[model samples]
Target: MRTLAPVALAAFACVAPCAANPALDALVAAYPDHLAGYESNDLIFRDGTRLPIDDGVKGKSFEQLLDAPDIKDQFAIPYPLGTANLRQPAFNEDPGRIRNQAMFVKMYGDCRKGEVKAQMKAVPWLPSRGGGTVMVTTANGVADQLAKVSRDLEQLPKEMTQYMVPSSGTFNCRVIAGTKRLSVHAYGAAIDLNAKFGDYWQWSKPKGGTLAWKNRIPLEIVEVFERHGFIWGGKWYHYDSFHFEYRPELIALARQGWPK
Candidate 1:
């Protein structure tokens, strides 16, 4: 019997640590063991590492934000919370797309240097469906949460299992294609679902400089991952329906009714 309900995500808002920047507060609370708190202009870690919250650069283009964004830039585009808020995003409105590479590196360690693999452990993936396993980081209870994701996924109708089993892959020590920035998979904290039913903006290649968002992954599967602190790429303007990554901060902020 499944004991965890998606509604339990509401607790992310109810008990987040209060601070000037709610994003930072959610970030600290999400990974309690890795983060301490934020100072006036820096995010302080439990290991005494202080990373600047802002890069002091203004008016950065979309590409600039993608390539070189500060920690706070992660919250520049607010992530819409649930199936209720799903919509066709405006141009370049990619919430959870702008990442702070340095920040992730600080906590998850660099995969190139083989620091991330040391924390990698296999999580059961759709056991009842013969999905086998995928490697994920043990950091911040990610492995545990993914295990929960697997359990919840199994509870869905058996036919839905076809879309989830045989994961695309996880824990890849590589950068996102055509970019120097490391993928969340490089940190062993992202999962790509079965590609047969997935859709990605990159594959669409729409005419002109426009993006046509497409998604075949069911919202039911997405909601299960969200309940366990994963954000779906289907929500992004540059949608990659197969991608789901750990980013509990955005989830918490959305529950707090932010990005207004």
Candidate 2:
């Protein structure tokens, strides 16, 4: 993994009040196949469509953002990288949780209409750890990035192997559980590790009005994913330890210390 230089860390420590970071910038720049750039609070598309950066709703409940989110709404919660496990996250600690359906569908193509398959490329999982082949999107070098992640992960200690290999799945075009919105998996840019060692909020009973946060995925594995422009669901308040999705926006801001 590339270490964060002390000077870079110092610059990253300062949070921008209402500006996009390099990670988001990278996402926009990387995906010229779909997007144009950001103009004020909107995501400009090459097709001349402008998607708002936020929904203009401040302080929304977690459920609201999930059910009804605008492009801007996706940034409502900041994703925390490199943090220790928490017993419980404050309500709405769902980083990379708010997804704008229109934005994603525009970029990745809606699978319901059978437009997603063309961009997919097969990638091998942790081959050294006995993992098999998995499919991911070739968009914005996603396939190449995952290959790099696989190569790096293979070099880790044997003890860290199980958490990464014997993979769960990749590239399923489907709605998220309990919602009509398509999952990142539909884009073929996300992966779920071994399900046996994963912890999901829906799988557990809620304590009071909140679900307890639990994780078994190692930080070392997470660092690898982040280095390759993926974000871990374990960082969410409604944590899913095995989940890692390609979300360069959050990763860039995280590197800049926006969502600490």
Candidate 3:
């Protein structure tokens, strides 16, 4: 992980007021157990650690944000929820893609160091579809939420089982492809549905050209997961239709009213 220089810290320390930032408000509200509040430019944790909200940079390219993002960078792209119509995401508009690594490490525990596996618990997948139990983190009630999601998904049409049955995976301790950054899976907060229907950016990438978005996951399934606080990767420009991560903050912001 990259560290911010003292000068950069001082520059972004002037965080905007809470009332003026619904995204920040949602973030604080989403993880009440770990976060105390936000002040000036720092996100105050319950443990008394203050992380700088921004990195004192503006007009950051998508690559830059993906490589080294602070808290505010996570909200650089406003997520659009309650929509099912298939459409292309604007270039590099990956809402939940730019995560604040330090913040997540603090909230979910580091997997590489064995801190994450300790908190993991098993949750049953679509039982009716014969999908067995999958392990996920218990942090932030993720296992509980996933249980709820599974129950709801099981109620879907029998045909939908093909897409949900035999879940691709839930928790895995590994970095993202070709990057040192830890994936959400490393923290046990994300899951991939059936691999047979999965669509990844790299696999679909044409030789040297713009990244195209493709998805086979049904909107009904996506809606069910979103209703339970999971954000679908299908919404990203670099789409991963089969992936969903527990990120209640983005859902809360979209529901309450995201900035236009």
Top lDDT model: 1
| TM-score versus the correct structure, for each prediction | 0.91, 0.84, 0.90
Better of 1 and 2 by TM-score: 1
- The 10-residue segment with the lowest total lDDT in model 2: 9-18
Give the runs in model 1 whose Cα sits over 4 Å from its true position.
Answer: 1-19
Runs of candidate 2 with Cα error greater than 4 angstroms are 1-27, 54-59, 84-88
Q: Going through the candidates in order, what is the number of backbone clashes in each?
A: 0, 3, 1
lDDT of 3: 0.85
- Return the clash pairs for model 2, or none: 23-252, 53-72, 54-72
Best prediction by TM-score:
1
Model 3 lDDT tens row, 91-165? 777889999889999999998899999999999898778999999999988999999999999888998898888
Q: How good is model 1 by TM-score?
A: 0.91
RMSD of every candidate to native, in Å, equals 6.8, 7.1, 6.2
Off by over 4 Å in 3: 1-20
